[model samples]
Target: MIVVERTFTVTATPGAVLGYLQDFANAQEWDPSARRTSRVGSGPIAPGAHWRHIRKMWGVTTELTYTLIAAEPDRLIFHGRSESATCTDLVVLHPVPGGTEVTYRMELELHGLAQLATPLLRGEFEKLATGGVTAVTAALDDLSRPAGLRRRLGAATPNRLPTPAEETGI
Candidate 1:
């Protein structure tokens, strides 16, 4: 088994940060290793929420089915399984001075033929694990930046409610 962990603080309240992170589909938007993610079924997310994720690491892209094994306002856990590997992911959030402190960890277990290449795989997996949380931190930084600064930097469009005229198609 291989395990990786990371912790960081972001400029968002715990409630807000957990709300965003709980949407596993957002992994595609914020996680560099995640190439795509799609919800598997309709309904509110709960302990059984499922998602299909396509992730690339070590120059190989693979698909996995992830099930939300646990969910809470400040914690979330997911179990992902593929033909040759199982991954357990845990996320914990804590309130902090200016934002939330997030702890993310993942454990990977290899099986069958994959076990034979564990040495090579561990090295690559370490790379992915090391960089994963940093990707999330970068995303939060972008999201937490002031709107005016984002617009002036030409990185984002103005975030505002639509004008009444536009809303009314005038």
Candidate 2:
């Protein structure tokens, strides 16, 4: 098994961060690996709620289904399964002195041929995980900026208002 975790501090409140993270549809706006997300269950997300997402990896596309196993106002835990692997993602939001601390962690288990290539695969996973963390950090930074600055600076804008999508390069 391999695990990767990253955290970022954002000016947004925990509530705000949780609100954005809880919206499965918004995954495209922040998670670069996600091509699209579709809800599979009715009503608001909670334990037992399910969703499907198509992700791109290694120039190939794969679809996975995730079931929410646990959920709190500021934390979410889910497991995802695909033909080759299974993984758990934990998202946590904590209130801090100035804002919120958002953390994302993933634990993965590879099977069959994937397990045979664990060493090489782990390196790739690390690169992907690091890239993901960087993207999340960028997204949060953008979301926390001022709107006026974003509009005024346009493409050249430095740290002005940034949409989660723009920040994460999703």
Candidate number of the best TM-score: 1
lDDT of 2 by residue, 1-170 (tens): 88888887887777767766675555555566777676674786778877777778778787778788987878988888888789899999889998889888989887787777667767777787777766656655566678664322112312122344765999
Q: Backbone collision count in every prediction?
A: 0, 0
Q: What TM-score does structure 2 among the candidates reach?
A: 0.76
Q: All candidates' TM-scores? A: 0.80, 0.76
Residue-level lDDT of model 1, residues 77-102, one tens digit each, is 99999998899999999888988899
**Model 2 misplacement above 4 A:** 141-170
Clash pairs, candidate 2, are none
Candidate that scores best on lDDT: 1
Candidate 2 global lDDT: 0.72
Supply candidate 1's per-residue lDDT for 170.
97
